[model samples]
Target: MNKGYVYFLTNYRRTTIYIGVTNNIHSRVWKHKLGEGSLFTSKYKLTVLIYAEEYDNISDAIAREKQLKNWHKQWKWNLVKQNNPKLEDWYDTLRGW
Candidate 1:
């Protein structure tokens, strides 16, 4: 029974956005930071994790990721702002988790 996560990543300039789902947020994020996650993420340099939501079911996490991907850019940005006003890289916070 693995938990899952839906996360948002943006570049340093916060100009590009990427959304993804994973059963292990830490390792997945680490790969993205190293520019090995996906061609889209690598090309856009979307390494900073700005928002994340946990789910008990991986299917739910995947569904949520799909939903967010279809959302308008402004809507996505607003969602990130609601959860992370500062839009800080959340990788450091994962250390305590």
Candidate 2:
């Protein structure tokens, strides 16, 4: 079975946030950073990965992404903070994965 990833992205100012899921987190994030991922991400410059969760099933990853998207902004922020208290970019962690 294929695995999946659900991730949270924030802009440099940490004001904008985006939630997404993909089978390839590294490639997807690379596209977003290069301004070729999604219109919303490119428009908002949401390229700093703050949080990510792995799932054995792609369906669960998609569902979690949808659930996070529907959550309140504050709730989403809290979730990110819970995982990444410093809110630092985590793109580097994708290396060797």
RMSD of each: 0.9, 1.0
lDDT of 2: 0.93
Tens-digit per-residue lDDT, 8-93, candidate 1: 99999999889999999999999999999999999999999999999998999999999999999999999999989999999989
Model 1 segments more than 4 A misplaced: none
Candidate 1 TM-score to native: 0.95
Query: What ranges in model 2 sit over 4 Å off?
Result: none
Q: Compute each candidate's TM-score over C-alphas.
A: 0.95, 0.95
TM-score, predicted candidate 2 vs. hidden true structure: 0.95
Per-residue lDDT of 33-89 in model 2, one digit per residue for the tens? 999989999999999999999999899999999988899999999999998999999
| lDDT score for residue 13 of model 2 | 95
The global Cα lDDT (0 to 1) of model 1 is 0.94
Model 1: lDDT of residue 78:
99
Clashing pairs in 2: none
Q: lDDT (CA) for every model shown?
A: 0.94, 0.93
